[model samples]
Target chain A: MARSRNHEQWTSPPPFTQEEYVDSRIYSDQDIFEEELEKIFKKSWIPVCHESELPEPYDFRTTTIAKEPIILTRAKDGKVRAFLNVCPHRGNMLERAPSGSFLDGSPSGNPRHITCMFHAWQFDMKGRCVYISRQEEGYQDRLKKSQMGLRELKCEVYFGGFVWVTLNDQIDMTVEEWSAGSLEVLKPSLDEEPLEVFHYHKAIIPCNYKLWHDTNCEFYHDYLHYHNRITGFNDAYFARKNTGFDNGHINVGSFEVQYDNYEGSHSREEISFPHLPPNHWYMIDMFPGVNFNLRGSSLRCDIMTPLGPNEVMIEFRGLGLKNDDAVTRRSRIDHHNSIWGPFGRNLHEDLLAVTGQGSAMNPRAENRQILHGRHENETIHDENGMRHFYEEWGRWMDRMPSNPDKPFVERTTATSATG
Target chain B: MSNADAVRDSIYRSCMYKDDMKWQEWLDLCDEDFQYSITAYSPEIRNDMIYLSGDREEMRGMMKMLPKHNTDHSPLKRHCSVYAVDLEDDGSMATAVSSVVVYQTQLDGINSHVDAGESKVFLVGRYFDKFRISDGVAKFVEREVKLDTRKLDKGSHYPI
Candidate 1:
């Protein structure tokens, strides 16, 4: 048999041994994907939205996590709560729209309640089922509508900015621990002067959820981003630092970006975020699916959820300071749009890479080899971020991502996994 | 040509120039102070949103770096019809609204099969524009795209 030459970098400085290259099976196999939905997606604490989304009591934003629909709402008591969007009776969706206020907007003066369109079952902002149709006449003795409220999940608003929830409540570790101390480091920057999300959009891509995430973690893909190359990738880019904590969380340091280096590029002279200076960046990739980031004058957060084996939904939010003037807000908006907007110059190229890699790594195609062995002291070009992430991924699924295998947990256990 | 007709032609040529990838020609048509943005409203959050925004210099920078980026080979063809044109009383400025629908045709790459080459409606929107008319020529000062379609299939690197 010929020697396996999968890991060698034919042109680059560092050489990758066979162990250095990631195995192709993780990208192709169905068994490993299912395990991820349980071990990673369900168990992870995913950020749902910025708390500013529902500033008033009884306001709510609805979203999905790991294919499970969820609703995040503010209570009358000044607390944010999360629940499965499913109503207990007949499992109908409580709120069908993406977001809304429980308080009646009309002059009809109807009291605030979370009412299900079907069956006329009414719930309060705290998810208490206050009214049930025909409760007195039918099964009054046995059925207790008061006993049932919308199913609640463990939800917390972090650093007074983001709302995060976990489907598995017994995961033991707190949000701070799961993030491995990075959350604290980031909170000060996020909260100091306060930032509000000014832009929001979601795109469903034809790629695996992990593939969509790889675009963020893999640094060598910089070659694919011309704008980044032209205005970025200078001495500062090469001098960047990366830190990886436990549980697959990675924070890559910033290189001073010169947006003016490219022709027609304008300077971000006004409106930088709370802690950052002009043209600087801060990024944190939490394992599984959330990325909180700052670049130049705009702050952004992206959350990815798996739609299927071959599909992923990504939500992007652009943020600015709370007190920006019209010009500063416009400058922030312009800065945000230039790079992170749905029509951004960077994202399309990243999506193409993810989808293209997905297409090539499909089961029918020959199983391939992917390398994440670069070690330039964990700089922008290093593959250690991806490697660190996959290693943590392996620990959770109990299967090395490179040499993939099915991880079978009891089906009863999985029921709670979706809680 | 009448000033109104000249103004109308400039707007028509802007869309055509963009569709044809005649970048420099399109840049020449815009005023020095051009500002372009794509804006939308989300009933979900009850807020108006900005998907993209830039001025002339920023637009120029994006175009300059566009060539080096790995972009989709799906050439977008825009179908636009001028809906209304209102020149200001001072005649120094004008505003126009146009209905626009862009179709994407997969023209390049391994996936660019003949079947995939069939164009499809990518987005539907109205273009809200402002122009500065000087020396009997109209150049774009601002273009705000009010989009109706929020569920776009892929990343839209190019302006609508």
Candidate 2:
């Protein structure tokens, strides 16, 4: 095997390395971010919209896939589907609201097709354009409804009733395969009943997506949490096992923290709920931007988008078992917010740490990030998870990971450009 | 004091003492049947969503259990200044509107504040609230703190 090298340099460091990285690379490096938008985000099956958000026919919620706008809606048959949120005519955004049922200004609760506010161009739940304003007079029969449906995205629903969509039709991996390790952490909650997101919070962290992901992927930074002393985050038993699979996807970090591991990544900590393990924290970095975390009884799903190299927008969704009593659900929400909410103790500290890093690293290109973990352990685990990401990144960007130190490679074709 | 003044003073003192972290003094000002809450307008439904609402016992349990959990942000400082008061004829009840600015100070010394709201009051400024108060001068009969700022600056584990 090639001798593993630390990519840190004083004069000019590679944008990212297994070691510390410079701050400006995160904020200013458009080339690196575009590669991520393609290799990881566009190809990966991302949880675009939730099934619960669209309970009735024609009910819809518009969301983003990287920079591409998409909408999720329920068909007349009650099947959930995903479509590009842009209208077929005039390129106007079909729905302007951040989240709601429909955009036609019609009374809510009544079942009706989605009608674009611009020209009353209506679409069925399947995204087929059903009605167009003054159809027979101006345009004649040239505009076929068959060719004018809202562009559909590759979509699927998980066993837990969560909805996910992918831009690439060629990628063939089940949600189970993509989220293997995370599913273990999620099993306890999933085993009970289908989970629904009751509470949602978002923060646009001014840092790189990887910086925030590293904050969750590693367990060595408890000293930063001032409250961790009381919460038992200081224990040395908070060990982590980093594992990565083929295709540079499905990277998992499992910790043998101060909690009881019921079986897999699941833990029972007494800090929040007595049933929740105090010592366990498991996170799965799903290829590009999405990171799913199971911190005991509560579930936190984070989507980090590269607003730019330096700025990352992190949206958090909190999930709980569907049949929870009002009190139990509220308690879980309290516990989740206490630790990881935008105002929570743990996440706030982590955000500060990464934001501080962003400020310093972006301007100085010589810094590198250190990820030297257990390489010789019995299994193929190490900072290999991080390495796999860069390797895949290198593969897609036409750069060399073995020599990621080389000058940046610029791509002529926009990664978003269609084949 | 007139009944209107009594309810007005009661709401003022309760908010004042609560801001000072004087949980006991805040509880003492409330009536046995008092009701209190903190709510927000959800633009999704164009309706109000209550973030916190409870009686004295619920308040006590919340205050008791809050410090035990972990949190994401920093300390919050609330300033509630009453601007107008509407009194009932018998002085047994009253309605009060106030403006409030809640400042949340982060560890890095960053502070963000929510600066607007209106409060509805009853039993104009009294020692015991018109509603039933519970626990050791440690709770309220009823309370409601509504927020005009829909998107919170940074959330806190405790009520506003």
Candidate 3:
């Protein structure tokens, strides 16, 4: 209802190039969301859980991949496995709790098979139903137990302590291969020593998940943090570079972000991760929902998920020294929590901005918003990252790729000033 | 209960809930010059750091103004169960220990609940008129809140 920020029509005929955006319809259409579920989330190796969360054998956690609930557990042999959290029969959720020790059964719960709570149908962790209770009375010769266990999902763990799961049956790309340039930014901290997650915080924001992803991907908005502005004035951290790869699914946007300065405020400084040969401050907004950022002594990973069109849940994890002394560990936690936690002055402000933007989008109260900036090719001021996201989104949504002669989808919601 | 025991009870009642935002009631259980802090033990650093440090008046000002400024997050409540009670020899201050669990409820736009964590505390272990004691009552001149869960799940505009 607040007055819409002044801007140009990005998708219209004053002649914005196809390189800028595909269309706004992608934001509202449910069919598009389904297509994305298949082409993107189903195929990409999405982060499921951190290794620290399941260190001991049988330690398990349940999370959702796209709309499907997934179970990630450390099997007795020490390998971590992921499977559909759904019970094979009647579709009851196998693991109701978020994080816990797997006690009722093996991570999947069927002795040599997985089981369904509804009918007591059991199956092994390998997705093969091994047994069924009341076999004679329920179905004299009718049901098949051999074919029913919790569905096994394609899963892999990266060197940096993150476990990823996917729905696709044959994705040849390894986690490192998928992450590409991102590994360069992560290797410094991850290489020196294994990283351990010291803190986990979740915030539920009222907005579509893309809004959060876009906010994370783009850097021009750093000027909105009133405190960061004063502290980061000298650093000029918002300066960014956008790079696109041949695979098209993965892209990297490197930008400088300020670390809290001597004045107790932050100024963007060009600080590079130890691994990247280029010593420029940077971040890589990984596609399909993950961001890796490095600032000073710490590293942060933002994992975002869509609860619905109007709700998003973001989880932030701060990584630190694996063998830090007691005193150093405490300091790391404090430093991490100060600017990253729920009360973090800067992030909390950014979240509010996105949620507020969501408020307007939810009601279809605004028409086409613009995305024009001076530095398109030059990373520092370019709006190209967004263009890249839309490019990839279009590919996954089955839309025509942005060729010089092709026309992209055109969707314009009726505009209104809610105020 | 002995005089020392009574004093310990009053201190626990007042100070234990300070992080929970029961400001006035918490202050009333403290002496006029009380020092209250919300600190955490960092295993990496192996030290105690103050996330929030305040006194009665400071808390009063914070409790009153925080909600007005905080634009993000849901509401929360903390429930604590006492586990240990230790009485000093002179009975000047009784040190009581207990575990606490904070449940956060998202209220502004979403309806949800999350538990922050279980914390441990030590209440002054006797009686002290100077520190806050009246026959069967005990008040705190100082109180400390240590939390295991450092990152507040939904950092409220208000205290714990």
Number of the top candidate by DockQ?
Answer: 1
Candidate 1 residue lDDT tens string, A330-403: 77887787777768878777777786776666654555567777778778877777777776777788775655
Question: What residue runs in model 2 are displaced by over 4 Å at the alpha carbon?
Answer: A1-27, A102-111, A180-192, A227-229, A233-236, A247-281, A362-388, A400-419, B1-99, B103-159
lDDT by residue (tens digit), candidate 3, B22-119: 77786777777877655564442233445555566766654554443435444445465556555566766565555656554444422223222322
TM-score of each: 0.89, 0.73, 0.70
Model 2 scores a C-alpha lDDT of 0.58
True contacts kept of 3: 0.17
Tens-digit lDDT track for model 3 on A266-374? 3323222345433233566777778776655456778877666666778777766677777666555555555565545556667767766666565333334335333
RMSD of 2: 8.5
How far residue B158's Cα lies from its native spot in candidate 3, in Å, is: 4.3
Q: In model 1, what is the error at residue B108, expressed in angstroms?
A: 3.8
Question: Which has the greatest lDDT?
Answer: 1
CA displacement after TM-score superposition, residue A220 of candidate 2 (Å): 1.3
Chain A TM-scores in order: 0.90, 0.79, 0.81
How close is each model in CA RMSD to the real structure? 5.4, 8.5, 8.7
Ranking by lDDT: 1, 3, 2
In the range B81-120, model 1's lDDT, one tens digit per residue, is 9888898888888998999998888654225544367777
